[model samples]
Target: MTQVLGIVDIVWRGRNIPVEKGAKFRLGGIKNTAVTYGRKVGRAQEFQGSEVMATTELEAGQRWGNTWDPGEGELQVVCDTGQTFVMYDAFLEGDIPEITGGEGGKIELKWAASAPEEIGV
Candidate 1:
């Protein structure tokens, strides 16, 4: 079964933004590796550590302007399933949409791992 997890809220810079529908959160991990000469085969790889990235999108006009500062701040994402993710060294990405067609605006939050535990999540 495919379980759908919805984002409940996002707290950033001491302000909260209640996420509406169509919110998305993504996390990624990458290893620090390098290709080297192998003994038997052609080449091999050596990996040292991992890097992590966390990102999410939220609806604008709901405390986004007050909380978002480019290249600064941290964010905490709470989901409906009791899962929480802390995004450190966060920064704001993408432009806040402005239109008169009654369409909603969205802001994208991007962050990297700042702690040991956050490097793989």
Candidate 2:
């Protein structure tokens, strides 16, 4: 039988964020291309992933924005198939996560990576 792959969790700055069930989790496929003319002309490769929902606690008389801004550090996504993706130099891209009143509650955080990530099995 073939084993299925599943995203176990999303860890940032050494913290395991509680992700919502059925949340959107996608890894942007590795891409390579060459630029004909531009500022930086050369072959380039990119590695990125979709937003990783991070569970948060909103309390009354509390603030948002900078207070909840996840500075930057190593971001990891572990899979059930013993696959791990590590973004060595990564930081929070967007200013703040989307806010809305609905099911449970979740914050969508962009997995912005500066360079190629290290894939381990």
Q: Write the per-residue lDDT of candidate 2 for residues 28-110, one digit (tens) a residue.
A: 55677787666677877776544443454444554564325666677787777887777766677766666656744445666
* Ten residues in sequence with the least summed lDDT for candidate 2: 50-59
User: What RMSD, rounded to one decimal, does every model reach?
Assistant: 5.9, 5.9
lDDT string, candidate 1, 1-121, tens digits = 7555754566665676655465555553444444456644343444332122233344444444574556656666666666666766555654543333334443334333333223212
Q: Supply candidate 1's per-residue lDDT for 47.
A: 39
Model 2 misplaced stretches (Cα beyond 4 Å): 21-30, 34-67, 116-120
How accurate locally is residue 101 in candidate 1, as Cα lDDT from 0 to 100? Answer: 33
